[model samples]
Target: MTRATASGKQRRATLLGVLGVFTVHALLLVSRAAWAQEVGTVAEVEGTAEIGRGGRWSPASVGTAVQFKDALRTGHPGRVRVVFQDDTVLNIGDDSHLVLDEQVFDPAQGTYRSVIHMIKGRVRALVSEYYKQPHARYHIDTPTAVSGVRGTEFIVSYDAATEVTEVVGITGRVEVTSPLDPTHHGVFVTAQEITSVARGKFATPPTRLSDTIFRQYLKGLEFIGGGHAESLSAASPLLTGSAIPRSDRSAAFEPPAAVAGAAPGGRPNASHDASDLLHQPPGIVRALQNGNGDLGVRF
Candidate 1:
């Protein structure tokens, strides 16, 4: 071949090699995305809980796989709890609505992100152990406010009637901000503190969570600990005293005695690790008062 023809052939060969590499990389990305799409499974569902996907609604089951962009809702006496691959858990209260906006839980690539939307009602979150990773992110967006947390356990409640959004920090730390005041930055909320966001302005100052109301809410859910009990984030006494393993619990609906004395809505003390969470069966967790759900915890 002529020198000019040889040079052209070499250039074509180089271009083909580059294209082939790009094609392979693209395929790997597609496969990885499919693998990563499943962030967690529906650990528990109680009462009339339903999931909305692609505008269609279906009742959630015990082992249902919860995917990204799925909206979950519950009617009266309904609730749900979902646990991710990394052990991070989410609890949805009765008459509440939440959407899983994003989930990227590939720890190998150091990509850990969780963004959920609280359209209405209540949601409790237990940030994963991987949450402390620099690139990890976890947030719950409400109609009026957005709460960002790090390795924390917190509650977010929204009342559509008054348009009030409440954020209660139980462990770790949380930063709350409202879109109304983008320039206002964020309001840092520590454990045992609570914050609120009304219809218009930015977030309110952090305050101590109300013990009475908090326990009342817990009692109502009656989250059982075993035999279809909800995940750890639902409060089977995530108290300061001991470590409750999920695998050790019996199938009965009763929780350990330590659970009732867990000091409702208290400040975050020393033991904020994942070991503090009580272990329970994965289904229909009702809050156990006095170690049993027969009667609500009245103190």
Candidate 2:
């Protein structure tokens, strides 16, 4: 073989080796980032927190990347709040064991499926408004019941010994159903409402949660970082506190009675003048319905 030709072949082989290494490294980086993207951040932590992944337990602190299949546990004096990709926050109270069973968020397509397994203890969540942008949904699997919602805030606490799951609604509504009673459709607990699910049975119908009890549950569970007041910004423009007024918790869920010529939905007539939209609108008929419009004052 010609010496020059052999040398050219050798150089080509060397070039191919360099390109192969570059491609492999590039792929490795992509995979690593993808793995990290499937995780959430520990926004705030108090006392002691630990995470179990791959059957190994490790101490956890703020900013821990809590990934799917990782179980987070907090001691008696511990609490942790995890912020998901779309800024949804789950505040876990002490003596709690939570497993991130599934989490997928795709903003461009507006699709999300968040599922968590609560082995025991309590968790308060502010579901992102983007949750229902397309096919978004969230679920919490407790020992006694499974709770689901689209975008709202609620709390779930389970007692392993009693096999009971207590669910309370702070802002949005929650529906709880026992796995054992698959056919039973559960009740929807609205703001300031509370309910319980017993072992092998569906949830009890929701009842009003007294203001005193509701305030007690909120003791340490609040958004700590990222502008605490904007906790529900991702859900809607209204402040989280105003979702249900103290005087009218049930009014938030019940549809307004229809005035004579009103459209199917209770919204002010589309043709109405903007000035009168809040109270009276053209073609809304004689009876003025939906008291105040204060319930939904926009941001």
Candidate 3:
């Protein structure tokens, strides 16, 4: 071929080579995105809560998609509710740091698995029954302990300063074990039971939950909206001390302010309608006082 023709052919070949590389790079990006599956969504957020990915933090709001390995954190008086793809609900309390370590939902094989690592503070979980599949498992790992559940409602609190971990069972059963143990020998905490794991120790034997600790656990997970600091302050008595009067128990059960148009006496108007906003479950106040086992709330 002529020299000019040969040069044109080489240019065409180089262009095709560049285009092929670009196509491959784009496909790799798409594959990476697909591999990072969305494991959950932020159903509600109050005060200062953030999502962390790749070591960077961003403000979290309702409808924010959470992928595997994402970190969730909250500031003082901040609260967040996350609903996983399997309908498992996680309520992160104020001043908490948690990470989604692993989550997989395989409908074809009827399997689901998840691991949430709690670095500090508290979290309440309302695990859906859909996780009852034979091979399904859910775990919440703390610095000292690991809580495993199949289908249950429970609370986990980790204190970074003290290196202590506490697990309280609201309904069903939760197995609390030391994270360092390979055998997974643990204690089963059932409804109305509580267990604690101290630094470098196995979980304490499960025992009946005390009214004082139960109230504190519930308050930690309760939703806080505007002006909630006042409510929380009012419930300070419940957070402290080892015992509280049964009659005074209602003092800690303050409900959040009604939506703008949702007040009982207000003129009927459009407003957000969901139990998540009205965080308190029906008759929860009574349940607290009566010490009943019917304190289940789906949110």
Candidate 4:
């Protein structure tokens, strides 16, 4: 061909090559966005942990993609931490068996939901405040009861032998109710409070826990093998007593208000001041000022 024709062909070839590169990059971007739809990532794993589906298991490690319906189990001295897209964190304790029953995060529609089926053992969760948004639901279901939360840091434990489920609220709130109850009546557990639901029974009223007992429960979730046990220092929110907003909804059974009684000289009784423990739980208020200090109030 003539020189002019050859030059024209060369120009067209270069244009096509650039277009092909652009197309490939676009496709890669789309692929990555789709892959990110998976529920969460295994942020940390220690000792013997397995994740699987359909009863077949494989060893889990950091960066493992946790998907819908995925089952996770932790053997002796094992622990797994999962971080979700919405900033919720879950630390599964040793000897735990759980399934990610349902998880959906769609920012376009402003919808978020997560449901964990805890067959046994413990899961310490720092749930995201996004769960309080409209059309959001977060729940941990056990054989005996369902522990639901809008946003909170909490620990859930279920005992297979006793068929009992217990929930301890560390920061925000957790609502524990019996699955068998149609009326959905349950107690609202606030920060530093705890409740339990036994087989065929409703959730018990939330009881305030002292700082000593609360710290002991948190120590149980530390990764012993990873040397992360010291992570629960005074700076930690659980220990420092950082306050999260309380749930706007009321519980089926709110703690009784401060009982009115005569002290003397037409004044309210001093004993009545301690009655409203639900709003001002002892440890939390005290810890906010002095880390790990004694809460002067006795439950």
Tens-place lDDT per residue, model 2, 207-245, is 887878887776666554332433323322122112322
Expressed as tens digits, the lDDT of each residue in 1-299 for candidate 1 is 99999999999999999999999997665544442244455655678888776577878755455555668899898887766655676778889988888666554456667888888988777676677888788889888898987787778889989889988776779989997864466798876688899988788888776787666544434343442232234433332223444444222122222321111122211222222233323111223322444221111
Over 4 Å off, model 4: 1-37, 223-299
Q: Which ranges in model 2 have alpha carbons more than 4 Å from their true place? A: 1-37, 223-299
Q: Order the numbered candidates by TM-score, best leading.
A: 3, 1, 2, 4
Please tell me which predicted candidate would have the highest lDDT against the true structure: 3
lDDT of each: 0.63, 0.63, 0.68, 0.67
- Models, CA RMSD each: 11.6, 15.7, 13.4, 18.0
Task: Give the Å shift of residue 234 in candidate 4.
Answer: 20
Q: So what's the TM-score on candidate 1? A: 0.64
Against the true structure, candidate 2 has what lDDT?
Answer: 0.63
lDDT by residue for model 3 (185-272), tens: 6999998788999987888999996877677667757644332212222333222222333333222222222222211222232322
Give the candidate number with the greatest TM-score. 3
Candidate 3 vs 4: which has more TM-score: 3
- Candidate 3 stretches greater than 4 Å from native: 1-27, 223-295
Give the better candidate number (2 or 4) by lDDT. Answer: 4
Error of 4 at 124 (Å): 0.6
